[model samples]
Target: MSEVVLTGVVKRYGPVTALDGVDLTVPAGALTAVLGPSGCGKTTLLRCLAGFERLDAGAIRVDGREVAGPGRHMPAHRRRIAVVPQEGALFPHLTVAANISYGLDRADRRGDRVDEVLALVGLAGYGDRMPHQLSGGQQQRVAVARALAPRPSLVLLDEPFSALDAGLRAGLRHDVREALRADGATAVLVTHDQGEALSVADRVVVLRSGRVVQSAAPGTLYREPADQWVAGFVGDAVLLPAVASAGAARTPLGTLPIAGPTTDGPVTVLVRPEQLRLAPASGTDAVTATVLRHDFHGHDALVALRLADDTRVTARVWDSTDPVEVGAEVAVRVDGTVRAWPATPVPAPAAAADPRPVHPVA
Candidate 1:
């Protein structure tokens, strides 16, 4: 296993900067995923780590040995790193055994190492098969086996499952993750898929515009995102404008509990759809809302609602719940801790507006 560390890493192309002052650490034996949209520097970061791209500034180190920095840059071949690209990149003319053994020394190649790696990647007894004979998923597994045959300290997967169909990608990614774990190989995966990163990685690093935005465990990143941008990107969030005073924020949904260091002023509260509940608008804490629409998605439903104040909110309900129809009046209940931030400035409200009863949904 190897620990990767990048300090003040910067990469540029002419006037365009792909990575700007990025600092990150990947723990030994743990799978870390670099997640971001396209052109967000995730791929460039991977290339720099693999020694394929040189850094304009900062340093890159693997297992405490400096690989890229001022006056020091190691070639890709000497880094002892293995890479699996989007496609399997297997030689059509070579058999699985020959491809895997290509990385082994002549003496090692003659041993049972090829068989061992094939079995490790769940491709046992298929060494004699040509690359073209295997399915896409199986071919990728062979690529992984080939990368592991030499037993390098680190492995880099560059969207290895992106090319496969959804169903095939899911199953192949599971097997690939398990294979890497079973062998205790430290891996760095780069992808734009949020589900893939959250499901398979021990740590997720979100980047945007050539900068690291947030780095945390999957659950923490999902539940407690750092800002509005991170919250919106990580999952579904309902943002509402409100005012904070005396430890509570009075939002359109009514006064909700908030825990954060903020002075009295306008704020924006973020509530997840799952945290809202619906029922008859009779309880003192329930606020009246008209069901605007219902989106039934197999296992659950996304019910859109408009409050008496005209603020819209969405709730995710299971199909097992009582059916709700459009234009139906219901009570909305807030069910969990509320996250609030300084609200963006808006124009003043118009005079002579209709007055309506607003109740707490807590």
Candidate 2:
């Protein structure tokens, strides 16, 4: 396993900057996920590391070796970084065994190596099958096995599970994560799927536009996002407008304490619906609102509430909530730590000494 590091890494496509000056470090033996909306720089960042694209600026290093920089750009084959892209891109004519074995060095070809990768990827006996003969999930497994065949120190996966159906995707995703961990491989996965990124990565880097927005453990990111963009991008968030007087924000939901880096007079209060609890209005700090619309998703229900002033807030309830019906009055209370005002940009490793504010997530 190897630690992957990038410093001032950048890439541009004509007028569009595919990647800005991004600096990050993926801990050794850790599965790091790059997450963002479509058109963000997530995939470009991965391509720079994989040597699939040349950078206009900055450096990329794997383990302790420089892979890209001034006069030092290494080619993909020589970098020893394996990539499993979205299409799997398996050779149609090659059987699973041949495809996987294609990566094995002549010296390492012995001792059931072919069987080993297939077994590791849960396609043990399917090696003889051609790519077209296998199911989508099976073919994807072969793709993974083929990448791992080289036993590279670093692996990069770009939306590798998109082809599989929902049920199979979930199972195979977990299996693939486990397999990567078992091999002690350092991996970086790039995807737009929040659940996929959250479920597998040891740490997640949420990107926006062409820069890194926030990189944190999944739970920390979900519980307390660095800004509105990271929070909203990863999952559902309820943003409410508020007026700040002193240190507290006054909403129709009563005056709630808002903590932030800077004091902006009028700003938005960001909170997750799960943090809201319903209670009687008179006795609590809760503000009253009327339920407008609600949706029940299996075990959880999302209720959209409109206050007397017409401001809306969404609250998530487990099961069908008896809190209040449509047009019925109810009190809303904030229970967890949430950003009360505009967010300050987070700093990156490249700017560790510079101390300038990083770009905010848009």
Cα RMSD to native, each candidate?
A: 10.3, 6.4
Worst 10 residues of 2 by lDDT: 353-362
* Quality of model 1 by C-alpha lDDT: 0.84
Clashing pairs in 1: none
Off by over 4 Å in 2: 245-247, 259-264, 279-286, 321-324, 343-362
Residue 356, model 1: Cα distance from true site in angstroms: 57
lDDT of 1 by residue, 25-89 (tens): 99988899998777778778888888887899999999999999997899888888888888888
Superposed Cα deviation of residue 246, candidate 2 (Å): 5.4
Clashes of 1: 0
Instruction: Please give, for residues 1-362, the per-residue lDDT of candidate 2 as tens digits.
Output: 89988999878877677788898999999999999877677767877787877879999888999999977789877888888878778878888888888878786667587888788888889978888898888877887888777788788888888877898999998899888887778999988899998888999998777788889999988876877667677888887667776777766666777765547577667778888886555655457888898788778889888877888788888757454577777777878555765534433322111111111000
- The collision pairs in model 2 are 253-287
CA-lDDT, candidates in order: 0.84, 0.78
User: In each prediction, how many residue pairs overlap at the backbone (N, C-alpha, C within less than 3 A)?
Assistant: 0, 1
